[model samples]
Target: MLLLLLFLSLPPLSAAQLCHPNDLAALLAFKNSFSNPNSSLPSWDPQFHCCNWYGVECNDTTNRVLGLDIASVDLHGTIPPSLSKLHHLQRLRLHKLPNLVGPIPPELGQLPLLGYLVISWTNISGPIPSFLTNLRSLSYLILSFNRLSGPIPPSLPSLPYLYAIDLSRNLLTGPIPESFGHFLLSTALDLSHNMLSGDIPASLGNVNFSRIKLSRNKLSGDASVLFGKDKVADTIDISRNSFEFDFSKVGFMESLDVLDISHNKIYGSIPKQITEAVYLQFLNVSYNRMCGEIPTGWKLKYRSESWDNSSFFHNRCLCGVPLDPCK
Candidate 1:
């Protein structure tokens, strides 16, 4: 009788109660928000348990919603604010829906555990929401290949755990925030192919970034601060900008591998210090105002076969090993 009494006190384990009622309603509401979800999410039917819905993951012990990953779906409509109902949502991705539009909902700031938030390859527009700073657990922020415009939120770096950020290939305009120099934990940053202008915060010179790409923008001023013998940055691509710096003064970190600073107003002989970058596999200094003989690193000749004729061309004054002999 004691065992039967214990069994009778346990919650029902019916298929309909597989997930928290709040999570189930939130999922159904999210499906309803989309105008054409049936073709992509047929498994999200009300007759079945919400945990069995495609792209939804639930915790085994609590049966609470944990992840909602929906990509390449024919979803058409704004992201429903009702998604905030998933109090335990940790990963939220809505990628490759070219038709999904509108600004990121403010309600998302309510998700305290959200770590990976990606809504790329869509028509999502408007400024990046500053409220995103509230996600104390966020680590990855990928909003690339969209129509997002306006200034990047400076508060992004304040997120203590943010590890990577990619806001490339957008229509953003304005100068990168000076507060960006305060980041101490972020390792990778890509703000390329936007309309950002003005000086790169010299404060960034102190932060040790592993990879930083600021190519194809209107950014000007000396970018030499990003280079230093003490820094360990492995990749630095700031090509095709109006940057005017004396390349000779720049220092190459031993960890340098990819360096592209072409198509700028940079004037000076190619720095011999670059030869010290033993791990460098990609180098492009072409289409600048640089002059004098290119440094044939005793190490460069080993990789000379990979250096194309155009790699050192258009500088008009660069000469030697790969080109006609210096005059």
Candidate 2:
């Protein structure tokens, strides 16, 4: 009789009690203040609970809210600080919400169980909150094409599980932090189209990468030394900057498919060694002080625009390919 009484007294699991009270309260608070221009967010009535909310998902056994996806929802307002209350949240996608503004909440870093985060193409501005470095379980973080400014925090590399990080197309200024080299496990690191200025960190050459784009910045120094022979994938774009150095000593990019180092202050001859890049498909080194016979090779013969320039007029020493032989 005692066992039966104990069993009968236990509250039954139901959708109404899907999440922790605090978690539910936090979600409701966020919904109340933010303007959802499209009315895409589902009715977050407490009686119905979060289980039926548009983008939210609950763990079947625990009934705790585990995901929040608001991608392209036209959400406007600051990221609610109360979002941290949902300790079990595993995925958060707020991509392309141009209306969203204000600093990314530091409280987001307090989520111990979070995994995926995508806020790209939003109006979110300010330094990436330092608290984010604590997300040790993060696998994918995409904040590219935002208005975020300031130095990328050095602590980012400490996250052992991070695989993809895209911070391109921001106003971020400062040297590519030396800490970037610590992300040896990263698959794609895109820091392009920023105001970052400094020598390409040589340490980056040590990390194996699949696609690395550092183009259209104020970055300088010899490109050859900055990208070591890592035999990874096939893309490296460091074009449209003030890099000035000799390209002759630079070794071949055997695995490279696209290389765009155009419109820079680079001064030197296109080294014969470059012909060894067997897999090169796209090459653009135009508008620089490159002089000498364009190495007759499979890639160069087809890419006519790869050698365009007024620099050829200044570089009286250059010859062959698009230009007539040295006079």
Best by lDDT: 1
TM for candidate 1 is 0.93
Candidate lDDT values, in order:
0.88, 0.77
Candidate 1: give the clashing pairs.
none
Question: Residues 1-327, candidate 1, lDDT per residue (tens digit)?
Answer: 999999999987776677788999999899988888787688998778887888999998888999999898888888899989999999999899998999999999999999999989999999899999999999988999999999999889899888788999999999988878878684688999999999888888867888899999999998998889989898999999999988988888988888999998889998888888888888889899988888875454235356775788888588886877898
Looking at candidate 2, the ten consecutive residues that score lowest on lDDT are 302-311
Deviation from native of the Cα of residue 15 in model 1, angstroms? 2.4
Reference-based TM-score of each model: 0.93, 0.83
Give the Å shift of residue 322 in candidate 2.
4.9
For candidate 1, the clash count comes to 0
| Model 1 stretches astray by more than 4 angstroms | 1-12, 298-305
Candidate 2 per-residue C-alpha lDDT over 1-327 given as tens digits, one digit per residue, 9 for 90 to 100 = 999999999998665566678778878877876876236465666767677777788888877888888776757788888888888988988877788899999889988888888888889999977788788888788888899999988888788888788889999999988878778484678889999998877777667777788898999876665454545647878888888877666665577777777777777787776676767767777777877787766544244444454324445366875667656
